[model samples]
Target: AQTVTQSQPEMSVQEAETVTLSCTYDTSESDYYLFWYKQPPSRQMILVIRQEAYKQQNATENRFSVNFQKAAKSFSLKISDSQLGDAAMYFCAYRDTYSGGGADGLTFGKGTHLIIQP
Candidate 1:
């Protein structure tokens, strides 16, 4: 079993600013995937970005990016030019590629409450 931790329960950022959410995990598997998901008011789990354990390069999508340190088992999300819509609960998730159970083997952190101020 694996566990993910988000030390900060909440974070705040002014509109159009930048913010980074930290995440760390413990796992015994050598190959896996890391993901950042955003859950808005609608309660939809939107994929923000993903990073492969074997890939040395970080993953980025538009205003969202991840700082993945495989050796340190840390994956943090950075949101640039943050928008009001970006205000939501962010989750750090992990999945083992060889799990063969799909979403069933996914482990997630408690989540960070992101407050976007005007």
Candidate 2:
């Protein structure tokens, strides 16, 4: 079973600053996928970024980037030039490649609540 762990329960950052959210996972398989989803007060799950296990270079999207340490089983999200809109609950998720699309669902971490101070 693949599991994700988020050590931080909550975090706060000043507007226009930066923040980093920590996430770690345990998995036996090598080929898989990792994702970070953002849920705002509206309660919509938005795909923030994704990283393929086979890729050595971490994924970056605009102000968002990941520090993927495969050997350490750690994948962290770095939000630069943060804004008030960035305030939300961030969830780390994992998908197994060999699940055959059966009863397997995205395994998600407890989530980190990010609060932005304007």
Candidate 3:
């Protein structure tokens, strides 16, 4: 079985500052994808960033970035220049390339609630 874990239940950052959210997962397979998704009040899951297992360089997008440590199985997210709109429940997810059985979709963590302070 595979499982994603977010150590922080809630996090806060001042506007224009930076924040890092911690995440870790357990998987026996080598080929997989890791992702970070943000869900605001509207309840839409938006993909922040994604990383392929074979990639050594981390993936980055605008103010969002990830530290993918394959050896330790840790994937952490860093949000720079935090904004009010960035406040949301962020979830870490994992997906394997080959699903021998059926596939539901992505396996997500409990989520870390992000609060941006003015």
Backbone N/Cα/C clashes per model: 0, 0, 0
TM-score of 3: 0.95
Cα lDDT computed for each candidate against the true fold: 0.93, 0.95, 0.96
Query: Could you tell me how far off, in angstroms, the CA of residue 99 lies in candidate 3 after the best superposition?
Result: 4.1
Candidate 1, poorest ten consecutive residues by summed lDDT: 97-106
Q: Evaluate model 2: give its lDDT.
A: 0.95
Candidate ranking (lDDT, best to worst)? 3, 2, 1
Model 2, backbone clash pairs (residues 3+ apart or across chains), number: 0
lDDT of 3 by residue, 1-118 (tens): 9999999999999999999999999999998999999999999999999999999999999999999999999999999999999999999999988667775489999999999999
Give Cα distance to truth, residue 80, candidate 3, Å: 0.4
Cα deviation in Å at residue 59, candidate 3? 0.1
In the range 12-116, model 2's lDDT, one tens digit per residue, is: 999999999999999999988999999998999999999999999999999999999999999999999999889999999998776665645799999999999
lDDT of 1 at 53: 95
